[model samples]
Target: MISSPDDLLRLAPDAKSLEAGRRLFYSRRWRLVGGDGQWLWGEWVYGSGQRATESAVHLTAGHFVCNCRARERPCAHGLALVLMLKNDQERISVGQPPSWVRSVQYQADRQAKPKPLKDAEAADERQGERLALMGAGVEELELRLLDFARRGIADTLAQGPEPFLAAATHLADAKLPGPAGLLRRLARLGRDGTEADIARTLGDLYLFVRAWKNRRTLPPDRHAELLQFAGVNIRKEELLARPGLEDHWLVLGTAEGQEDRLRFRRTWLRGEKSRRFALVLDYAFGEMPFERSWPLAASFQGKAYYYPGSYPQRALLPSTTPGGRPYDGLVGYPSFVELRANYQKALAVNPWLYAYPVYLSAVTPTLASGQAGLADANGEVLPLHPEYDNFFSLLAISGGGTLAVFAEFDGYRLLPLSVVTEFGLVKG
Candidate 1:
């Protein structure tokens, strides 16, 4: 059986699945749940008497199978069954496997066994073809962007989104889906967007295109960034090969969103010892949950392997020490000037970085001239984004006094993520 909630969370594919499993466990709808030495069996009922669907999970051989229609392997029902067993061992009595459970165990054993590769050479050939297509797509995108520039920004906007949309579709077909999706988003920038906003968007695209074209001349780290932007993925094994830093990492905040059928989760962590910030990303498809989620406002001792880059922000937690505890005090810049200076250093390393983590010490939340902002001890104020509606909550927590705040800055405005309160860490 799994050790704890953290172990079970590690098994999940994304945050959504972990949350779903938690809900299922708390609902108290499971029955006939028992565990043998190797296998666990359970019946879960969803909805009312008539509309209810009975789902079963057969957990064995370090694997699980569920009868629920969810495409996610193991599914929420299976996770909940594990959680139930962990919470109350007496709830699941050991017994001989039932016929259905045995059948599933046999199938699971067979599926777990590795099969010989059918055509390794053919797989390599296919990969080569895909790379070639991507190269052609990049060239085409450069030409399209140049043409748009020559036609003038006003004329291109007047022509509507058809051209950009069509180009995005073509890029997707060529297997450059990341850039393609970005172009589609850019096409939606209508008259509502300010002229400066439009120019910045265009400038970013132009920079990316030029950087990709001259990638060979760029540094290794910058080249890696270009490759990532073009949809190339770096394997975990490759990242783990580098040296890892062992530190007590404080889990600060998280943001989750869905694009197409994939859920993207970004968790921010700050190393207590190293004073380095890291961004941990998790992606899941369909109803699958993320591998693991760091408990917010808690600190864990772990080894984090940083990806190769001049300003290494993305990292992978290959191994972690078991228990985590609440952090005592907030650590960061004492003033807005120091914060801006640090931001400039990070920006110099990677100009394309959109959002940067900022932690301000002893800043009073204020609303002056109908604008929300934070003023440091020195009276230096940094304006908060207008869309950040949680300032009232932050104000209440601060009680009109100076407070420590963690936020994301997009060069212009700050979006608060969490504030250190007298009671505890409060998320914005």
Candidate 2:
């Protein structure tokens, strides 16, 4: 299996794709060996609950397939095996294949006249164990995300740095610190208490305070990074400290990336001519499969607040806890800009505007188009427009309405609204 972290990050995570594969799973016992990234190689029991001690080689990746008669892509047996691996169950011990399995392998080998990959038959229970652990970790992180959404941003920030502080404190206690440590701590939190409880209990006391308090004053880059560490992305900022729009915004789509153990969602406003705004959210606990919750696509309107930081509307964590514990790492979310003229003007002047017209990048400026435009920027550009990339495009469309435009850049890149200014819209 392509175990490279980057490859694993890029694996597709559509549940529909896995649905058929899930059916193939049944009551059979499976032993998982190492795989190429998304691919899982293993052996399992087959046949009508007879528990055919005969081991069989199975391969599962974006989809599941077994060289058995079950015909189903991901037979019931496959689903059970995956579920077991996902739930942190026991690991499959490494050893020689049973006599029945060896005989089957011999026949297949004779027919194919091919040499098996070195150690291909060697069972690796550890890999299965890891996968199961990672699956659980991912599910936990997704649950937390939904919880955060329910709590709303104000309520989360209102906690005032305790969680962030605790995260920092936990970082300090460990001596041999690195990315793994940071990820481990996040994974621990994913399974345990609420974000609030975790913040108050874990790590150094003073360090947490410093990070919590200093977050208010940290530079944009620093603040944004800290927030990312907590698996949150920075979307928009309110440099003027204005309150966000208070309304129901629809949750559009959510996507997962192999590059970062993160997920993003889109939300749009609802109403007549309800303008679409792309808001990007992220997760960073561990190697869990992507999250899928369609009901989240409902039209929800919430206030969008602007904070003074480079990350637009994000926060940051400290390097150490209040108790002097060294800090771990964090995650980052990128902001979407139309690169249009009107948006540039708003960004430059810093005036208090209630709600203005803003359009996504692909949306044409015509009456036929449903997209909205924010404002005009310098010279002759429309300024701010939405531009979503493949990773985030789904987030733009939720419950029939669109929220944001996923861009083709890292979360840190900002699209200049000046790039999308319509010459006709500008008084040249």
Q: For candidate 2, what is the TM-score?
A: 0.26
- lDDT string for model 1 (147-217, tens) is 98898778888888898789999998988877787677667664455556567777777787777778889
Q: What is the C-alpha lDDT of each candidate?
A: 0.76, 0.35
**Segments of candidate 1 deviating more than 4 angstroms:** 1-45, 48-60, 64-76, 79-127, 158-165, 286-288, 322-330, 368-371, 377-380
Error of 2 at 225 (Å): 11
Q: Mind giving the per-residue lDDT tens digits that candidate 2 earns over 1-428? A: 53332332234244553553344343335544333323334565556545432213332223343444432333443444454445433544445555544565566556556435653344245445543453344344344445645776456556554543353344433211222234344444545435653443222222322443466686655555444433333333222245444433433233333334433432222221234343433443343222323233244334545344333422111111122222121111222343334445643332211123233333212112443232212212122223422212232222223223322222222231212122211100
**Minimal lDDT window, size 10, model 2:** 419-428
**Cα lDDT for residue 296, model 1?**
70
